[model samples]
Target: MIARKFWVLALGILMIGFSSSVTAEVPEIGQKAPDFRLSTPDGHPVRLSEFTAKGTVVLVVLRGFPGYQCPYCQKQVHDFLLNGDKFAAAGAEVLLVYPGPPADLDQHAKEFLAKQNPLPANVHLVVDPDYAFTNQYGLRWDAPHETAYPSTFLIDGQGAVFFRKVSREHGDRTTAADVLGELERDKAAHAH
Candidate 1:
C-alpha cells in the first residue's frame, strides 16, 4: 500500500513537470513572428526572416515526433506541393516548420522530404527541433496526444502577422488552397 502511494506521488510530480514545459508555449496572431535559424536535411541553414521577400510570409508549423508521421501535416505539405505554382504567382513565400526535441529532427525531416515535394522557388522547409522557435511564437502544443496544434501564420515583410490559423484538433488544419486564397485576398486588400 505504501509503495503504491509513493508511486502515485512520483507520477504526479512527473506530470506537472511535463505539463509546465510544453503547455506554456502559446503563440498568437497580430504579433511579430519569431525568427529562427535551423538546418534542413541537407544541412542548409534557413531563417524565417529570409522568406519575407517584399510580401507576406506563410508559416506552416508542423509536428515532428519522428516516432510517427502525422497525417494532417503530410496532407497539408502535399497540398502545398500541388499548388506551389499558385503561391509563386502570388509572390508570397511559404515556410514549413517542424519542431521537436533535438534528437528526432534530422531523421524526421528526411522522412518528411522523402516523398517528391516540388515546393515553389520561394518555399522553404525548416527544422525547429527543441521548440526554440515554436515556444517563442506561443504555438507549441506540449500536451499528451499532441505534438503541436497545426498552426499557420501570415507575416508581413516587417515581421508582423496579418493572419493566423490554429487548429483546435489534429484533424482540422489549414490547406494550400486556403493559404493561396488568403495570400491573394491579403495582397488585394493591402494593394487597395
Candidate 2:
C-alpha cells in the first residue's frame, strides 16, 4: 500500500527527467552503468562507482529546473522518501541525480528536500554537475520547456544494467511496484 505511492513519485520524477531534454539514447541494458561523483544537498557526496559496487543500484535521473518549480518533480521526491523501507527491503541503493547547470544544482536540491520529508538514509541525492553523468548515460534532454527527461535504471551488484525505462513525456514509465517486481524476479532467478 505505502510502497505504491513512493514508486509513483519516483516514476513522476523519471517521466520529467525523460521528457525534459532531448538526448541521444544512452548505453543500453547489460552494459556497465556509467559512474560519477556529485555534490548532494544533504552536504555529502554520492559516487556512482562506489555505490554500484556495493548492491543493486536504482538510479533515478531528475531534470533540475529550479526556475520552473515542477510540481510533478516535487511529488517524486516525496514518494521515494516515503517508501524508503520497501527500497531497503529489496537491497537496492537509490541515487537521484540532480542534473543541470552547476549553479542550479544546489538550489533545486534544497527545494526538493524542502517540499518533501528528509530522504531516507538509503537514498542519495547527488548533483550531476553540468550533466556529466547524464551525458555519459546518454539520457540528456535538449528540448525547450524541459531540461532532461525522466529515466530509471536498475544496475545489479556487479554494475551491469538489468532494467531501464526512459519516459518520453510527463507520465508513464517505471513504478515502485515494477521495480520491486523486478528485484524479486531477479532474486528468485538467482536462487535457482
Question: Which candidate tops TM-score?
Answer: 2
TM-score, every prediction: 0.80, 0.81
List, in order, the clash count of every candidate structure: 4, 13
Instruction: Give the residue spans of candidate 1 off by over 4 A.
Output: 1-27
Report RMSD (Å) for each prediction in the order shown.
Answer: 7.1, 15.1
lDDT measured at residue 48 in model 1 versus the true structure, 0 to 100 = 74
lDDT agreement of model 2 with the native: 0.77
**Cα deviation in Å at residue 172, candidate 2?**
1.7
Task: State the lDDT of candidate 1 residue by residue for 1-192, as single tens digits.
Answer: 999999999999999999877643444666777677877766799877777657778888887663578877888888887877887788778888887777767788878878855556877887877776777767778677455668888888888888888886776788888887888788889888
Q: Estimate, for each residue in 1-192, the C-alpha lDDT of model 2 and write its tens digit.
A: 789999999999999988766554576889887666787875687677788777998888777673566676656766776777999988888888777767756777777677565668788887776777777678777677566678888999888888888887766646677777888988998899
Best by lDDT: 1
Error of 1 at 10 (Å): 27
Clashes of 1: 4
